[model samples]
Target: MHERQDVRTILNRTTNTVASIRFHLILVAILAFPLISGCQNLKPLPDGLSLQGGEFPSSEVAFIADTSWIDENGQRQVEQALFDDLFRIIDKAQEVIVLDMFLYNDFQGPVPETTRPLAGELTNALIDKKKQQPDMLIVVITDPVNELYGGLQSPYFEQLEQAGIRVVVTDLRKLHDSNAVYSFFWRLLFKPFGNSAANTLPNPIGAGCVSIRSYLELLNFKANHRKVLIADHGSTYVGFVSSANPHDGSSAHRNAAIRFTGEAVADLLQSENAVLELSGHAPVEIDIPRDHVNATTSVQVVTEGKIEDVVLAEINRAAVGDKLDLMMFYLSDREVIAALKQAHERGAKLRLLLDPNKDAFGREKNGIPNRPVAHELTAAGIPIRWCSSMGEQCHSKMLLAQDDTGRNVIVTGSANFTRRNLDDYNLETDVVVRGHHSDSVFVAAHEYFEESWKNTDDRIYSLPYERYEDRSFWRRRLYRFMEWSGISTF
Candidate 1:
């Protein structure tokens, strides 16, 4: 009996040892997953993306701005022209219409009162157009955030689809992982257990609850940040790229956009088609006729990483006695910061009008990124000013460089000069327009900058840098770490 009992005990101990070994092996594989998979190549950049251009008549491109400012009595005032023009462009379309907007939902953050129903208005506009021209091809492409990565249903998307509009939700997995450390495990584990459109967890950005999967997917920290609208208007194709969103929470923000028609529209369509192909949709079949050219300015389409390339090149091209003016929402890209300092050192007079990074959907934010970055730039003697936002962001992303030789270069569109936006993690679109300083487009862009900078009217558009200056060493360290690690939302 004693011998039998000893054998039984040995067998039990052997079973426990095998189980322990299996567990450790599984753990090791999980830990090594990111290092192995994260370095793989991302999807090939779409054709005709980085660089495409032609000399276009200055009349073919027009600059438009939407300004939101506060009066001396603290009344919030808005002069909006961007969206009004967009609606008119949509109304005028006769054949093909393609829109790729990042935020197209009515996700009202804390301050719902401050927001206009931009999403509803935009949705109605598209639906109305589709109803008017049933055979006209209309495609809407957007990010998954609107649906909370399948955790919540988007009424706006549903309404559009019901109107026979094709909506394409971008496949973010096809893009490079911005937050590599978290994305590996998310792809391996969380993604397989897909999500439901029934709310089960509290929503991160707004009122309703979302699924656990939505929160899990949000940690990946990436998006399809492009906001573009292309359409066939009468005899020509018109294209618009802007930083504005059809989102209620962002309706009051100050923004900038440009309307253009020329051979560049063909390149813009091709760049957008790359997004469609990656998202598993067939490209729109439309031929944009190359219109007659009376070359008065050079216009080029630059997307994704190409924006960083063009911006840096333009900055490095600055010489003594040149002027550089930048207006941005976020300015935390390390390379851009370095380039700005170098330009300043080369005697290029630099003026930065930046958001204070203080208000977001009515919530007070500890000024990060912009504040620390502002500190760094100001310490180096570069001039900086804070947009006097009345609970609305100065959300324009534009860079205007004027050379002493009377040549001017204007870079503007959806990119915010941040790592995620410029490093190809998020899709971006910007047009570089080069012309003599006297060109109408250049004149309009300059007037927009000067009026806002100098407060030419009774409205208060921007304030002195000292109004929201931050010199906290710890915050600076924190911003540096976050920007390097790709963990924070810019």
Candidate 2:
């Protein structure tokens, strides 16, 4: 009996040692993976050829001159040529396609031909391509908040997955604003049952393949807010960092996308893969080399958590510069507001287009009145425009800056000039494009700004601000009850 006891103790010790070794191995692996994959080295532009134009150079890189147009009715159309060029590049994708959008939904239009959603058509095209080439790779990454509020669901994503394409939904937690009590209750009640008790709600995408990790990630503080598309391993499209979602509500919003070929696509793919890793998705294969292409035009790749303040700095730079054109769905950042005021004081010509709404995400914050920033700007003698669409909100974040000699700059992306967007609880990206070629693009964008400005009502805040107290007592009570119960997280 004594001998048997000794043998059992030895066996237990060996098992514990093996377990410890395995744990350490996993820890090391996790620590090393990000470091190995995160390094990226961009190459410098070659000599004798500047991003500015001398001749329409034919060497792999091509510059699409930006131009603005004024329609017969004086509607400003800036960057029309740039958008046309971008679409042309998308039309040329020959192989694998990947897209990540924050918001997307199918919308029925007045005409059957125009009824298809932008994402739906794009998905169908990818599906057809997958059928043709069995080995084709396709991917999509989207934000959960946009999916829920924008009326987008997983069936569409699952359909693409069934066709053997990769679809990843980034669980951006900050955007959801999950109530603390609700999350705690879910963790306590549902975690041990391993059943659909509370937190383990039904996966919108169907079946056993539902991602628990995604839902959990959404409860975190950081989020992946990028909206991008890559095709044929070469071409890429990046949506403007704005409130615009791929849904009917945001369809009418004025938005912009930048298209690029050559090495920039690879850079974008790497950035997306980083987000996927953070979301606990399997590591995506990195296809582009560290120093793959010499990017002639200046480009900056911004990420969440870090470098957020840098984005604000750029906005400030533009606002305080000689001339600034700003378009945004929401603008409540105190720093940005102060910067704009200072810029105006500095004799800068500032034009702002603000959405006449409470919040771009359709929520109230800090009991503040949901008035358009245009009112404040216009009162200060700055040209402020209120953009309105037939059925959708104006959802674009773009800034155009110019100096006396047409040295133009353009800043575009998903980052809103708001406290939540700038300080915490959102993911955003913005890029500054410089050089003469970009100047032309800026001019074109300026034209569009002017046209939209003309269409805006000068007195947007003249009407009395609606209050929640106007609702029926029962309705108000129900809303307050939901807020208290933590049901508002849904």
Candidate 3:
């Protein structure tokens, strides 16, 4: 009886201790929850403006189709025409130029005699223009992902800042859902510790007029993904619905961007200012044109989560009673597929070029069955091909369509054809350029598509190993694992 009483006392005391610990933990969590929530809701203000400058003249703008290439010396060059256009604009900047990009890199040569890198020349030209006109306002807005993914803290960003340019860095964690989760936990365990680390991470530019701000619209993940560069001389809009940052590596990535001139420039500037205000930046007065300027063409700007069903409607319109040439990085949207099929039944001749690694779903490893959209299209008798391994993956989002009457259109931008891209995730920016000039544009894009298609193998329908070489034990194991993941998109 005595031993039993002693055991009961010890057991009761231990239970009481555990209960106290649990209660304390709950209390701590309750207190921390508000802090975490507050951080997640960080809204600095100015709602969609990131920089300050006067609105550009809508009539003087022109749209351009930009290209990427590697020079003979192996330096990546973003379209030469783009650089030339920038030079012209910087020279004429009367008040301000606001530039926002996801990536920016300048490849200065080791020897003074070597021709300046594209970035270097552009930066120098801007600096010279600033020297000629001391009061010219210049502001640069860059995504914080540059700190991790690209070589951002280089001489380019530094030189721009040192030359009296105002630069703002968007809090990247607030832009994407995945980063929000990581940043929340990161701040929880290390509060001030993390802040200090961030401070010491090297600003390269000596931190001139730099501010960190949060974006509420971006928190939803379907916010702004459009890429625009605006200046007072003339504005240009280069839209790609992909991951081509304005950095050097992206200059080599297979991508497409369009430039605009005339009245379309004002619309692009307005959209860019909207993002800036959303990021808590000051707004500039914009001049809206009353009539279409230059050789007028119809252009539609489509953003995710804003329209009821513009994407589907556009696809349906383009695919119906037309010959379609599409170059896609990812294509998993079911409605798009249905519409394409319907179009085929309606007598549209379709040709497709898709990245083999990125199936209709996403990346496939080992021999796992991918949700290959190409297989379905091929079965339906659409002429579809995969890009070759030696070439860079076909990452451009383009749609070229022509009707029986020869009315042609080209839709290009940062948006992919995936469901997440079309409906949920912030992925693309597409502009439908329609006019008499579209025939030439469609022909150029079609030629590129045909070249890529001819180089790829047509047996992507077969299982991974059935068309490839012998696999190791681990490869076989990985294949089984992926097969069981139940994640194929097709």
Candidate achieving the largest lDDT: 1
Residue-pair clashes per prediction, in order, are 0, 10, 34
| CA lDDT scores, all candidates in order | 0.87, 0.49, 0.50
- The reply for model 1, stretches above 4 Å from the true place, is 1-19, 34-36, 41-58, 113-115
Question: Best candidate per TM-score, number?
Answer: 1
How would you encode candidate 3's per-residue C-alpha lDDT over 403-473 as one tens digit per residue?
76676666666667654456523423455566543444455655655544453232121122123233355
Residue pairs with backbone atoms closer than 3 Å in model 1 (clashes): none
Per-residue lDDT value at 200 in model 2: 42
How much RMSD separates candidate 3 from the native structure?
A: 8.7
Better of 1 and 2 by lDDT: 1
- In model 3, what is the error at residue 184, expressed in angstroms? 7.5
Q: Model 2 Cα displacement at 86 (Å)?
A: 7.3
Name the lDDT value of residue 156 in candidate 2: 68
The residue-by-residue lDDT of candidate 2 on 1-490, one tens digit each, is: 9999999999999999999999998887566544432211022211211111111111132223232234445443433233344334345555555566665545323322121255565567667777877775666677764344222345667778889988776644213232444344334344344322133444342222233543553343333455566565343333222233454333334565444444444555655665565456764563543334443344444443222455445445553346787877666555677777777887788877665553332333321211434444555777654554223345566766777665666666666665545543445554445545343445556666666656333322112113211324454354445433334321
